[model samples]
Target: MVVTDENPSAAPVTVPVAPKRRLPGWARSVLWAVGVVAVLSTASYLTGVNTLTSTNTAQIALRLALPILLAGLGGLWSERSGVINIGLEGMMILGTWGAAWGAYHGGVWAGLGAAIVFGALGGLLHAVATVTFNVNHIVSGVAINLLGLGVAKYLSTLIFQPLSGNPRQSPPVPTFDTYSATFLSDWLSGLEQQQRVGISDAAGLLNGLVTGVAPLTMIAILLVPLSYLVLWKTRFGLRLRSCGENPVAAESLGISVYRYKYVAVLISGGLAGMGGAALVLLAGGGGYLENQTNNRGYIGLAAMIFGNWRPGGLLGGAALFGYADGLRLSGGGKAVLALMYGLVLLLVVIVVVQLIRRQWLAAALGVLGAGVLYWIYWANDDLPSDLTPYTAHFVTLIVLAAASQRLRPPRADGARYQSGQR
Candidate 1:
């Protein structure tokens, strides 16, 4: 009976909760991107290899990014509706043909409209197969790809061949020479020349930003924000997203899954078509070639994944890919060499840090990464032009490997939906 009655109400032990120690993924990505850009800018200034710092490079990067951005946005819309659109390439090819036909007959504006129509047609076809008929998504996409290229080639032979005397390409299209006034272009151009005279490096970078920019470039840039607002802040977007994530639940809530999916897919096609029109406009004198798309549709898909299907994230991914492409166009300059070496140096430091922390596996991987960069640096002078286009892909692969764990696709995506199947 003398058992020490444990104080039933003994003071509750208070363990202090640890505050969040890690930065959000976006914040960390921003810091890393800023550091990389700063390093490259300094290298360009120090070496006087202005290609890396020139505004022309910036313009080229933006142009290169635009089509990818459009396609990525299209993919976002389609996939967000629980339908995978692997036929973006096919849609883009169709758009390219449409643009060529429209430009050849009328003008750039007409070409844009034609492209949208063609893309919508492709989207309708895809929806019929994947949504209405419940065909395998991947199979439908593959069939679309083959059919698109064949159709484009057939049309090219009939229309472009008869008109331009060449079946493989279309004649040049009219281009917008400048968005800014003459005075602004002159000022920026003058400042660009002064870069060699010790003016700010940014001056060179601004020279190409405004002068000779196409109207489509401006439109594409505007679409980024417009898409963000429509997809994230609007009621329709919420309903569309619900269909993708949980169609059964959405049906129970009185949402029309089929209607949303159709709209999304069509919108996706229209966006991809716009990308094709932009590509033709970007080519200007070069015009549209039989294989002008060069696999950009697939790249757009990769960008969508890299961005985790967000508009803002797609912007950054597009910029990275575009910058790499611009660098490739520069043809292995000293600035690029410096950048590669700098990356190697950073990886070496990471290896050291990992070793100090006794992270044997991580340190080994860091060593491997450093070695790869060193080899790329060693081969820079003799690197094949054919390999240049793949630099963006390499960077993307590395990023995906490092961060894919954090990415979460919409639930129920690609899953067949039947009413009351819950």
Candidate 2:
């Protein structure tokens, strides 16, 4: 073959490939949580702060995480199957009332069953609207929220008010007693009293965490792994996720998209309901009250977003939020205050660096950090207990705001899917 001038050189252009610079979301999440925990724990150990590492705080963190974790799992199931379920709040609210009603008549188990049923009903409504009628998923969810709350409020008047003469709250329901074995309990109690170096109230913390823990809490923790197994390791889970990612392709492949979507949504509702039941049970003999969910459903959704739609990520997100909540609920002592100030100083240094780098957003956050420091300083001696409960919300907001671009959802998640339409 004769080579012509138009033939050019026989060489392939080599564009340099960029190295993989971003870490996996799960690894980043785990590292972030561990770093925070390490920082707090080390501060406590070195300074004898005794603030964040107490048994009471650990127990509270678990208690706070259970509901959010359950709800986040529920959302994962539904959204992973191509349905956007914004009605989780309404479903959870119904679950609370159902739990109270069932406990009032039958028992705690019955209450749990009732909560599931109520949540399932809400899910059914959502499925019918979004899956069958082809209604907008967001609208359907909003309607469910309104309807669920109204139904619960009206039913409370007839069922709960007769018992307590207060339509807004139900009478005390039977609660699960704390589990404490004679030998284990005594040994742990004794261990707590005798502290060792580097451990510092570790026994007491462990005892507080395991003892008196509600059965539902254990179930919630177990569900984390169960969710991971079912969603990531099973054939059924793969099919369900396929439907969410591309329902048309799934339908072409003989997968029943409708069936998977229905199953996912129903399971989602049940999880949210269970979360409500767990919350009431965690209250320890206290009955359900109006608006008892306290926007936890929304918080759970935030956690699902934070977790990047994975079970392991969900666990980390739940723990981070739960720890913040626990801190808020249990105000710290002088040592804790010192640690807080130290953290503030660290934050201020970072913000100042950012300001020097001329990042406008960092400058704004710097102002906010300075405000926080001023507030802490103005408190004089003690930590501001009343404002603590909002730390979880604040942290959640900051994370979401900062990392919104990194978060992605299933492509076909909220789209209407009609067979053969794709």
Candidate 3:
């Protein structure tokens, strides 16, 4: 800050004051998300696009988002520790088999436990190949993927064929108990039905959160904050991340680069295993089946990339894709077309934000995009049937394109590391 001198003939004197502190990166991201949500909710309320905030849509979104959330978190753990875990899919596959085997022989909790162990094993294998033997990270990951698939298949045929009467699937696994905050949900439901703009919008969202959520859902949601605390706030996290950024420097500091990398990879596997168990217990309904993962591991990796390798960013990415998936399943093309309208609103909001930041070119592009999208929305009653199935992928591409400019990975995220070597 500056102030002028009182003397008429005196030159103005500059005064210094402390600059205002800016919000942290995570906080800013959250605020941006909240702003976008507000725009979307208002669009829903005005356009009669109820599906955008419907309880059913929200519920399904939670279910779909869980695996991706976990998988992306897994990638974070590995990458932060200086290892790129492209084997997340393989780990998930191992987890599926472990879950089925444990659930069949023990119970649901046992299944979850077994999955973690199995996933950890896959992680261990990755560590052996990449760290101990100096194998290429991508090559090690690909080998693990094939190995996991083959192992799952062999185990399934040997263990599940007689019991399930099918080689490709397992018998039903008992699901966990579910609970709801009935009172809050009821109140919110009532308010939502009243159709009062922001009030209804808040009620709808709160209602979805409080109504009929599984214990695993709560656990999955909690992991995001827990991860941020551990990875960003703790000393251990700093050391682990150091290995990713500069393993040689970390080793020089006696940080034990190999140890941190190993730990991170194992944790990565365990998280991915949890993702698999989530799929079987929460969404599968049936115990386990062949190819049940449905490439969610790959999608999770995409979510991780979209988030620029941050926990909060990945969470937002996962939720966006999940919402699109659920929308396609529940409302078909009309709901998707409704989403296009909401996107236009969101783009307009983006334009306003860009203008505030004096980003003229970006604001201009946003305006052009919004105009084109709204024109498309106005001309179409529904999306073509052929395009309906790729809704999640479509959204993922757009988001990645929008966010790609800002993404930065760890310095040595996928680089080969050697002890005491730069």
Candidate 4:
């Protein structure tokens, strides 16, 4: 019969305190590094010292960046699933050979399919070694790389031997005539035809931009968003991430960690294979070579770390590295290019180490160092040819540095399901 009236003016009911904003440390570092790179790269263009004109630079960056981005995405999946894939280069090489062989014999579609199959197989081998056999991830990865390279080289030699006579160079993959025309015209329009365009020298600039937009380059772009969706939105992705983060924990939850790890690694391989196929079909004219993948695999691994294992971030990192690669290939100060790559790798290492050690200052300094090096490279016009060997060697160093960070399996990755564990 009696209802006691609660105080009408009680302090506005506050729900239990909201959690404080906490940005991920890795994310912060990525942002900072990316920002610094963007500013420096932009400045280089404005100064006209790097020779990578604004439009051409972007095109080169995109063309170079795509394969690496794809590879990085693949690496993200495998590593996230708790399997380290050191053989990404090998997978790419194998894929390149397969694609080249298929295209030479069967056409473009066949080459692509073959590359994908080989890549998947590479992934399978990696999975078996690290997941099923519990092999040391690093050693297993190295073995895969060696195996892939040997197999590819042996097959190529067998097919194309007799040194001077029947060198196995496949015909350039056939393109729709209209496709080439349209692209060439657009490129010309962008450079020479524009009244506002500078008059100093337009021929070289036009050539560079046009060449950069290979058909495969477009495919790489499509893969970026697709990979993001696959990694974050699907059931399979959840399982893969779980396995990578804590295989044992995932196993306890009744999730088959081994199965997921196997699948993830294979998928990663498949993508890398696609990357190879793209190179051969789009860049290499359906032809196989001794080191056909051109170290793109290693570059991809670095991009993966530079991107911090996220698809978008990976894409950005890939573009940066790819631009640098393009510069090297296009006769843009090779020594400086080498130094740029080295500095980038060093920056990545420092950031990763700092994260591991919780040393923010070191990470900051590392990034600053990278920016300064890039500036110096941008400023230098006459690079030494003798340093070419050294620069070439740095490619391996870059890959190794990136792989080292990923060598140790993540704590929760590759977990296998056991009874009563879920």
Candidate 5:
């Protein structure tokens, strides 16, 4: 019940209570995703809010969610190894520069490789600072963020300015190719066009996921289960997580805590760097724009928290944030307002549950919230553009506030450790 406390970059610290599941973890994750899609399909069918399961929304969500998902996985690796990586944003910045420069000189694959290397280097620096020097993890991470941004800017001025006539941007670079599952897409598209309630909605949603999928997106998606297998099912993962739980115990068991920490943090940086690559290569008509990461690193950290620090959970979290973002970008305020209707229905459910539990005050608040949101949905044709842009952040804050209490992080996460100190 007790673990050493260290610098907390975000407020996530509650451990998760495992529930009964006959299926394997990965299988359960798939079921959960299917269930979510089913619910969304049904919701869209009933509410007549087409954006809920629209192909455009789904496609945009996948693209936007990739970076967040990658960043979250990066957080997972670092935290699971008893280190905290608050410098994910900075790492991503270095990645963008690396990807752009590499793509300019070589190709997309080359850019990916360069991004990973750049990101790993950043992780190595963090390892030296926190693991070796015992520097405060938060301070080290902040410094890295500042340094990364400055370095990227300087590099852009020197390199990209001459080529692109801009100091803060990189020239157009080759992006990863996208492929569609035409085999299924054709059938699904036919079903979707029929507009037949659940059948049509499900088809629409599925079609989005199957079409226009980029290679990096597929790789990033695969990493979710791969992370689960590596971290939850492997001996190396056990030892790495042990460092997070209790390094002293791990050391007594002949685990090299420092080596594992270094490795984990490095992998963390690599994944985050991949996120940066996603932003640069697949983020639509741009190559390493200034501040393109746009605080997604922090949001990804929030997603890790929301997911209770599990790969499947974080994937869901990232998708939720990405959906909100994509809805705003693609559907604009009309879509967001329609989305609010879904939220209102959700609150209505909460109100009923709280009422059943005899939680009078909570039920009342839920009612109030539900009523206000419903009124907004009823009155407004679209959300204000200013507020629409903040949809993802609002979702992040709401999710964290709601889910934070249920989260349980590793016991010794972020703690300063020394060999033979126990």
Candidate 6:
């Protein structure tokens, strides 16, 4: 009986199709930042206006960036597991001390192992406080940093008290002579001879390059891709991310969130410790000193952010920061150098913010502003010599921050999961 009506009028079924939403502000900002960096890098390379020697600069950048990158990746693991580890600096310091102590008493490998153990202990402490007791992550981190510094200082005084008396001459770690081969010697000789005029220190250049490509550098290179693989392609990584994003979901799915979190935090601590060990053993020649890490832990944190929580991205960010640092350490007009460094950072941040917001116009304006500022500062010829390093340091910090802000972990990062909660 209803066949007449059904045939006469077939009501149209409208399927509700959700409108495509624009990218989040943060995501746009990251894109803008990347664009700006690309533009600037291209300009620098094409113009050859960048004062840095490409070969030496790259080598130096890698040297500094590698250690920090490793530490930052470790931080990524911990934070991704919903555990905020502020104790990275302290862990690194402990590792440095442990490695130095181990090397002094045992062998280099023993020292490295000691650093890892010490670092793991530091991580365990953080895990107990944050995961078990649910302490404020920031406070816990600060405490760890203070504890590390205090312990390191006391230990340094106790062990190197005699050496301290002689101030200039500190105890030496076993330094491997890099220029043992004839080919290496020939290369150095050629480099020295290449720049005959205005080259006051060719030896320094040669030594820096030779030392840059050390065993530690090689190890760090290997670790980068390995880290990427582990974080993205492994079961451990999945568990770690799940714990950070939605612990309840992961737990229901038969994942022990606590165990995963603990493991992640400890592994982070161990990696940071290894970074410290590398700094002292490979870079600083196995000596304990105050502020030996030189804010690298903090930098590593920024690097993690810059990399947008991606291992590959982190390497690039670290390299940029490292290059900025190298320039500062290279001894030039401090004020101008500082200005350049600041400009780089400011530009990077503005670009990042714009990208995140999908405001290309704003990013472009920021780049212009940075360029103007840089030119103004570059024109000033009377910068203080002593202030150069400080300027460079500030620049490096800014760049690192800019680069790190682009990093984005999975949606569930740094959150705790409870039963029945998504």
CA lDDT of each prediction against the hidden true structure: 0.79, 0.79, 0.87, 0.67, 0.88, 0.68
Error of 1 at 390 (Å): 3.4
TM-score-based ranking: 3, 5, 1, 2, 6, 4
Judging by lDDT against the true structure, name the best candidate.
5
TM-score of model 6 (CA atoms): 0.74
Count backbone overlaps in model 4.
16
Off by over 4 Å in 1: 1-8, 11-33, 45-48, 181-203, 283-286, 333-336, 345-364
Tens digit of per-residue lDDT, candidate 2, span 88-201: 999998998998889888988898899889988888889989999999999998998888899899999988898999999999998765665557656766765564433445
Quick one: best TM-score, which candidate? 3
Output the lDDT of residue 369, model 1.
81
Clashing pairs in 3: none
- Candidate 4 lDDT, 160-274, residue by residue in tens: 5543244444434542111334666466655543433243124334454455465566667778778778778998778778777866677777788778878889999999998
Q: Order the candidates by lDDT, highest first — what do you get?
A: 5, 3, 2, 1, 6, 4
Q: Which is the better candidate, 3 or 4, if ranked by TM-score?
A: 3
CA RMSD per model (angstroms)? 4.5, 5.3, 2.9, 7.5, 8.8, 7.4
Off by over 4 Å in 6: 1-51, 162-170, 175-212, 334-361, 391-393, 400-407, 410-412, 416-422
Better of 1 and 6 by lDDT: 1
Residue 200, candidate 6: C-alpha displacement in angstroms: 21
What is the lDDT, from 0 to 100, of the residue 336 in candidate 2? 40
Error of model 1, residue 163, in angstroms: 0.7
Between candidates 2 and 4, which one is better according to lDDT? 2
How far residue 408's Cα lies from its native spot in candidate 5, in Å, is 0.5
Q: Give the distance in Å from residue 338's predicted Cα in candidate 6 to where it truly belongs.
A: 10
